[model samples]
Target: MRPILSALLLVVAAGAVAQPVAPGQRLDGIAAVVGEQVVLYSEVDALVQQTTQGREAPPDLWSRALDRLVDQRIVIARARQDTTLNVTDDIVSQRVDQQVAQLAAQVGGEPQLVQAYGRSIDEIKVSVREDVRDELLLQQYQGRRMREVKVTPGEVRDWFDRIPESERPEVPELVRVAHIVKIPASDEAGEARVRAFAETLRDSILAEQATIEDLANRYSDDPGNTNRDGTQNGGLYTTLRLTDLEPRFQAAAAAAEPGDISPVFETPFGYHVLRVNSRDGNRISFNHILLQVEVGEDEAEAARETLSVLRDSIQAGTPFEAIARRHSEEPQSAARGGYVSVPQTRQRDLSAEGLGPQWRATIDTLEVGEISEPAPVTLADAEGTQAFHIVLLQKRTPAHPLSVTDDYALLSQYALQEKQNEVLQEWVDDLRETVYVDIRAEQYQPPAGG
Candidate 1:
C-alpha cells in the first residue's frame, strides 16, 4: 500500500494561498473541519486544478485531494499540541522572509510582486506566515517520526526475494570517484592590496573623510548591495539576525556596538569593513564595504600545478585518500577523503548521465584506477568559483541486472521506504482516533472513528 501521509502540498508557490475574492465575485465555503482547523473548498479546488493542469480529472480526484489536505490538518493540529515539536517565532519569520524573497524574485521584484498580488509586501508576508508555519510544523513532525523507522539487513533481503527474476530492474552504469580539488590561492601581494584598501576605506569613514554609504556605493564588491533597477543599497542591511550572516562576518559585526566602525576582517569572499548603524536585542542594522581579491592567471596556474603534484603522488602509490585528506580544499568532501557523492543522498555510485558535462566527459576517458590530469572544473561553491582538480575513477560498473550481491544499497533503500510507509500509516490511524475530523461535503464520507 502507498503511504498514508504524502509530502505537504504547498499551494500557489511557497504556501502563499490566493486571497479571497470580493464578496459575490465567486463561490467559496468550508470543505471540512479537523478539530479547530477549517478546510476551505477553494483550497481543495486549487490543489485539484494545479495537479490536473487542464487535463481531465480522474475519478475521485477531488476526494483524494481533500483526503490529503485532511491528513495534513490532522498532523499539524496534533503536532502543535506537542511541546517538543514547537516551531519558534524567529524561525517562522525567517522562513516567511525567505519565501517572500523567492516569490518576489520569481515575479521580477517586490514591486512586481505587489502589483500581481494586489497588496503590499508586508501584507503578503503576514498573510503567508501562518501557512509557512504550518508547513514547517508538518515537515518537522514527519522528519522526527520517520527518523525512528529503520530497516534491517534481513528485511532488505526479503524485499529483494519477493521480486520475481523476470521483474527485476536494470542497474544503470554508475561510477565511484574521488577527487582532490585545489582552489586558486590568493597571492600575498594581491591579498595585502585588498586589506590595505579595506583599511583605508575604514579609516576614511572614521576620520569623516568620506561616508561609509558613499564608499560602499562607489567600491563595495558585494552584488547584494545593488538593486535590480541599477540603484545601490549603500551596503545597508536592515533587521538582520546574526544567524543570517556569514560566520566570520557575524563575529566581526557582533563585536561592534551601534555606531562603531569595525576593523577590517576577512571572509572567504574577501575583506570587509562593517559599521553597525543600530542594534535592537538580537536584530541589527549595518552598512559595510567589501573588497574581493581578484584571481589572476598566475594564481590559476599555481592551483593547477598543485593538483598535478597531488596526482603524481597518488600515481606513485602514496594513497589517493591520504593526499586528499591532507590537501583537498573542499571541506566536506575532503573530510571523506575527497569522495563526492550524489548531493543530498548517501549514495557513492553516481549515474554518468546525471553528472555535469565537464565531469562526465573527463571520467569517460579514464579507466578504473586511473587518475586524470589536473583540469579546470567548477566548484559547487555559491559563486560557482572555478577550480582545478585531479580525479581518480575508483570503480565503474557497467549496466547490469540488479543483484542482491551488487546492489544492496538500492535494495536497502526500497526496504526502508516500505517500512517507513507502514509506520506512517499506523501513526495516521492513531491520530484519526484522537483528532475530531468532520467532513460535510456531498459525496464524501467521513473516515471511521473520525
Candidate 2:
C-alpha cells in the first residue's frame, strides 16, 4: 500500500462517523495550535486508533499523536510559505485517482467504495486531494533538507569507533555480484500466433460474441489485471496517464475514442487489444486483453548461447562491463555495468541470505573475479519472466567483525543517516522556536524504562 492510499483509507474510515450535532457546532475540540492551523482532538484520536488497532493504548499515545500532528502543521505552514515548493493539480489528481482505484478494488468497486465512505467518488477525491498535496509537500521539504546533510570519512570512522568493541555488530557474509542478462527472443512463429489470438479476441468483442471482461478473465496474461486470490480484475485500469504506459500501448489508446477498440498492438510485454472505457484529457480508463508469446526451448538455448559467447569474450581479455553495457537485456543492471545492487539501496553489497536460492546456487562455486557459465534465472523487475544470464562474482567477504577499513560503505551509510537526523532535529527545533505553537493536549513523556 502506498502512503497516500493508506492515509486516504485512514481519513475515510475516521470521517465515516455520523453525529447528531448541529452543522455549525464543532464536534471535536482543538488538541493543539501550530501557526494558523489547529490539530483537532478527533484527528489525534484517529491516529491513536490506527496505531493501536484494538491493542491496549499506551498512556502517552494521545500526547504523542498530538505532537506528530503539530509537527506536521509546522512543516506544512513552512511549505506553504516557500515560493519554490509546488505541488501541481495534475500530480495531485493522478495520485488521488490511484488511491481511489486501489481503494475501490479493495472494497469491490467504485460504487461500493463510495457507499462505504458515505461520499460520491468526486466528493471523496475532493476530500483527499489536499491531503495528498500536503503529503507531497512534506516529501519535497524533507528531501531538500536531507540533501543538505553530508558525512566525511572521518565521521564514518568516528561512528564506528564510538561502538565499543564488545558491542560491535558482526558483519554477515556479503557478495558483490554482476551479471549480463539475455531475455529469450520471441520467435516469429510465436509472435504471429500471439498476435492472431489477440486479433481474434478483439473481433469476438466487437461482434458481441464475448464481453471484454469474460475474455480478460479467460485469456489476459497481464498480472496487474488479476487480484491476489487468482480472481480476474476484468482488465480494468482507472485514470492511466499516457506517459505511464508502454509507448505502443499509449499510442493505440490515444488514437481511440471512448468505447472504441484499439487495433491489436505490440508492447514489450505482449500483444494487446484494448478498449478505452473513458478519457479525460491525457488520462484514460480502459480494459485490455493481452496475449504473450512464449519462448521455446530453442529460443532459450539461443539466449544462453549468446551469453556463452559474451562470457568467452569477457574471459579472453574483453572488459565485462563494456560487453554488459552493449548487450545485457536487463535495464537496471546494464545501466550499472551489470552490477546488481540490493533494490532501493545505493549499496551494491548484498548479504548471501538476501540472494534468492536460484542466484545463490548459480554463484555457489564461483571464485572472485570469475564468470559463471550461462544459467537460467528470472529477470528482476520483469514479473518473473525467465531469462538467462552469466554471473561475475566481483567480491565476496566472509562473516567477520565490523571494521571501518573493510566496511566503509556500510559504516558511511549509517554515519550519513545519523548526521542527517541531527541536522533535521536542529532544523525542526529552529522552526518550533520561530513558529507560533500552543499545546492544549498533554505533553508526551517517555515511560520509566528509559
TM-scores for all candidates: the values are 0.54, 0.56
Off by over 4 Å in 2: 1-173, 238-256, 278-285, 325-337, 342-345, 353-357, 381-386, 398-408, 424-450
lDDT of 1 at 387: 83
lDDT of 2 by residue, 1-450 (tens): 113212211112222111122223335566678998777665665566556655878777667666666666777778777779878889889988998887776544776566545578998888888777877777787678877788998899999989999999889889999999998977889898888889899999999999998999899888888888977899999865553465456657767789988888776677888999987644578999888888988999999899999999997899999999999999888988999896646688898767888898888879998999998887666247789999999999999899988899899988987787677666776889878999976643322211
lDDT of each: 0.77, 0.76
Clashes of each: 0, 0
lDDT of 2 at 444: 32
Name the top TM-score candidate: 2
Cand. 1 TM to true fold: 0.54
Across residues 1-450, which tens digit of lDDT does each residue of candidate 1 receive? Answer: 011223442211211122233223244567789999877765665566556655877767777777777777888888888889878999999988998887666544687567545689899889877777777788888788888888888999999999998999888899998899999976889999999989989999999999999999999999989998999999999866553366557667767888989999887778999999976544579999889988778999999888888888777889888899999998778989999886656689888767688898889889998999887888877546678888989899998999989999988987887787788767877998999999877754322111
TM-score, cand. 2: 0.56
